[model samples]
Target chain A: MPKHTIISVSDLNGALKDVVEDTFSDLWVEGEVSNFKAHTSGHLYFSLKDHQSQISCALWQFNRKYLFFTPRDGMKVLAHGALSLYPPRGTYSFVVKSMRPAGEGDLNLAFEALKQKLAAEGLFSTHKKQKLPRYPQRIGVITSETGAAIQDILRVIQYRFPMVHVLLIPVMVQGPGAAEEIARAIYQFNAQSDPIDVLLIGRGGGSIEDLWAFNEEVVARAIYHSTIPIISAVGHETDVTIADFVADVRAATPSNAAELATPDQREVLQIIANLRYTIKNRTLRKLEVEQERLRNLRGSYALNRPRMMLEEQLRRLIEIKRQLLRTTQLQVQQARTSLQLREGQLQQLDPNAPLKRGYVQVFRDQTLLLRANETHPQQLLTLRFLDGSVAVVVNEVSQDR
Target chain B: MSQRLSEHTFSEAIQSLEQIVRTLEQPVPLEEALSLYEEGLSLAHFCEARLQEAQLRIEKLSLQPSEVHPSTL
Candidate 1:
């Protein structure tokens, strides 16, 4: 011991540093963030703490933008980075490269982040929603085959509308790859020729983690973009998911969705029967009223007096005949008077009447001579009296003295 | 007119039946208008029978392919 060499302070520090760097480098840690501080050098410094331990952490500015959301104090986070020793303080710390919100424990933060991102993309906008059919011919169901939800839906639909067809797209509602399977099934059903009228995407009640698939962004986006109207029936009445926000309608349960899809067949039948009865009764009442109206019309004076109507018509005919006779007689008398006057005027202007008054008409070749100018000298001419005619030769022509 | 009536398509038949019901509701004596009333009643019965037949076929369709069950409902 007395012969051992003395060690320098620098050597001691160097050896210790190498050991600490080797021990701390290339490690991952998870803890709640606390007392976070940002230095002027553009580096973030914070302590990652569990109930039992705590470690200092630093995230440089280069790595900050990669974080999808902001970090807050008391936020449980899983950080991946290398542990390094700060030589100035001779303290060991973590240099974080990437970080994410930790656990099912931080679901609220994840949900908020997802919700914000989806909202910014307009996934929950009203314009993206589709209207449900007023009368669905067929409904598609995506749930476990043996689940009570299916039974409930079937029972409700059968009771309400027996004619509606239900197409079951059997799929696992929980466990691995369930979300993908469900989304694919919906797409497949939509692509079919006789496509389902509406899609009921849901499951019975479960824990939040069990219902986590419905909360997934992929599932929500699928529902949002679905051409078919979706009725979300997930968990109990109180539980809601991202799927619910994007669905066209949200029902309290599977049975409720069935109720929404169908109208009561019995009630429809009853209504039809009632309509038939009302139609018959009203028709009978109308017929009775019409018959009574006809009877009343027959009892009227005009209808009852058939012989009087005929007699009245005959009397009118007689009056019209008398008027016609009077008009004809008056017209005939006027015509006769006019004829007599015309005949008298004719007799006064007649050459024959003049002949009858002791004057004779002279003719040349059966042509009557109207004046002395019409006669030619030395022409054979015929002279006609009222009842006698004579042929004569013109010996001399003379003008009237 | 008879061929046209006979050639009535499914939707047209329904429409004609409804129209007949509406027309029958007007004031015509049943005894005096027995032929028209009989025609209307026959049309109504025919429509109802067609619907019932279709319903029966739909009931047959409702039965799952894997199992053969009574489809009374």
Candidate 2:
């Protein structure tokens, strides 16, 4: 060892800072955060600790802008940066460049925690899910512009329902501000005066880190509160995000999302075709039934042989006429019999008939006496026979009782 | 009649045509049946025309980056 030489504290700190920077730079440290403080100037100051020891960390505004989440006290994080030192105080700290929740398990744990929280809030409830339109005329898409997700969606939509209007709201699917972008896009769509029927929000296959934006609370809440039905297709069939749980529908792929948004045009066309055929067939069948009824009416006796119907009526009329004549003849015979009987009665009462039966009538002058009480005592009388009449004078003055 | 058909969507036109067909199947007067037949035929034609004329339209909603910044979060 060399002989001791006295030196200033700054000199010692500078030497220490250089050694720490060279050795600890570009290393990762995982620990739970405590005493976290965000300065007014946008700098974050915190401590990374374990059960045994702890270290100070400072994240400047420049690096802090890239953080996907706000670090809180007791949050376990994996920090990337180098060791830094303050020479004046002879203190050392970590100058963090980037930070993430430590480990996939931690992320999963965070996901589970958020899911449970939102579930308690009724965000993932089935009753909250809106039913999609049967035929969505206008479809809104939320995804990256240059990704294969959009291409697949476009292809599937074109092939299935060609008439739909697709409005793509391109967004950053992954990055610091991606979740906000997606949520804002959804709000923008809702804000429009003319609303889209449904929204397809998704991306192609990717790792969890690549799909972290979709798992964000902002995105999940946006999907949960959306008035428009959302079909979440975050990744391949295996990848599940919070968005999927909160969305109205979960599609295995972006193409399937598009398919779910609209009815198949070909199938609708087939239905129309079948309806057309049915209408034609029904109309024809109706016409056939009517025509058959008309034919039966034309084949009836009254229509086919009108002359025969009239001849039958004429025969009935002739029969009625003959019956009337017979009735008249019977009436005339009865009248003749009655007249003969009356004539016989008059003949029986006739004095002329009695005279012809040898009975005589006496009359005085022009008057004839019918009873003794009606005769005069002294009067010229006439004796009339059936053939002659004679006058008798007062010789027969004595009245015969 | 064409303007009316233009106002109808594919589903609406099909539904109307179906209604007309169902009514025609009942005991309708000849004049009403003939008119319903004519209407159904035109609706069918209109639906077919719409299906043939329709084309998929894709549009991009141009959003400014500053308008949707994560600072709002």
Candidate 3:
């Protein structure tokens, strides 16, 4: 045997992998990206370059999903990954595990990152927006009380529509802690029992950094959750902020926002006038139609021939009377027939019939004496004959014996 | 009934007149049209009285926390 000892194939391969992987594994690299290509095979390939050095990198799809925004060429990024060498290609590369934005300033990058983060959370959905009242009874302005923006808004509102009550919620809109003050003002307005109908939040035209408070995530979220409709008038027409995106409505300027919150008196008057005219003309036409109808009805047969109507009623009355008279005559004839039949029956039963037949009857006073035993001596009595009357005195009375 | 109709407020009378006009404009039978026309005339008289009595007033709104300021124009 020579000085070197013989080794198995598996032991030699394991020893080579340990030397290659352990030396460069778990490395953090910072550089500008270039020649980046996201492969279809769920992996990203890019070259990390510095002024004097360059290294190839591979970020798989699993790691790419964690990135907040799309990675592009020439973007500065910090990547952490494991270093490895492909034996087949005989080239070294970094297999990235995570990455973050690098070149931009920390604040701006943080802002952009947070904005995209919240937007993904649906903090800026249009469906969450509320419509501003068409007619706001009270309008609240949240800005510096002495600012020209407030002046412009007030002037426009007072000039256009004087009916809207203006409420000024004074707050610092710039410098340190301005965002907190603005947010508190918004919440305070919300807590009011009878809050303003709409809130106008804005300032005059300014630089991006000057209006940064409105762009702050806190203020944007405050406006998002506000019960009152907010009209954002942060800057000029071209200037847009997160407040503008989150507000119910966005106006070009403070004056324009005020105009939106309060309707123009002239325009409203014109609308009322138009409505009045429509109502009047329609009503007049309706009245004319009704008058014509009435005139036509007055010319109808029922109204034209009053006497003919009376004659028809009289005819009905005469028919009813004839029916009544016929019924009454039949009832009377029936009654008369019944009376004559009753009279004949009475004549058949009459005791006076015997008197007319020459039968004699005796009576005392107005009483007929039926028995001789009823008479007493010295009793004066009147006798009634059929054709003559006589007076006599009863002596001794006796029976038929 | 006519005096009661005359007592209607401005908006009430206007609204009623609008209703009447709407009813009269419909394609109803002649008998219904005649009755509706009669109603429309009474509404028109009420509306005329309201307009005659209406006076335009422009007043500044009182800025209160709770009070609702009416539309001036």
Candidate 1 residue-wise lDDT, A325-376, digit = tens: 9999999999999999999999898877877888887888878877887776
TM-score of each: 0.47, 0.59, 0.46
Could you say which candidate leads in TM-score? 2
Q: Candidate 2: which stretches are off by over 4 Å? A: A1-32, A35-102, A286-401, B1-8, B21-30, B64-73
Tens-digit lDDT string for candidate 3 (A1-401): 56988787666656665787898776768888899998999789999999999998999887665455556788877676788866545567888876655554543564576578768888778899899875565688888776889889888887876656677777778754465567666766776786578999999988666676786656776787789999999889987777888899999999999888876666655544554555556555656777798999888786879777888899999999999999999999999999999998888787566677876666777888788877788998886655677888887877778
Q: Write the per-residue lDDT of candidate 2 for residues A179-211, one digit (tens) a residue.
A: 778988887787777668899999999878788
Residue A220 accuracy (lDDT) in model 3: 74
DockQ of each: 0.06, 0.36, 0.03
Candidate 3: segments with Cα more than 4 A from true spot: A1-111, A305-401, B1-73
Clashing pairs in 3: none
Extract clashing residue pairs from model 1: none
Here the TM-score of candidate 1's chain B is 0.41
Give the residue spans of candidate 1 off by over 4 A.
Answer: A1-105, A116-122, A125-131, A278-309, A313-401, B1-73
Candidate achieving higher DockQ, 1 or 2: 2
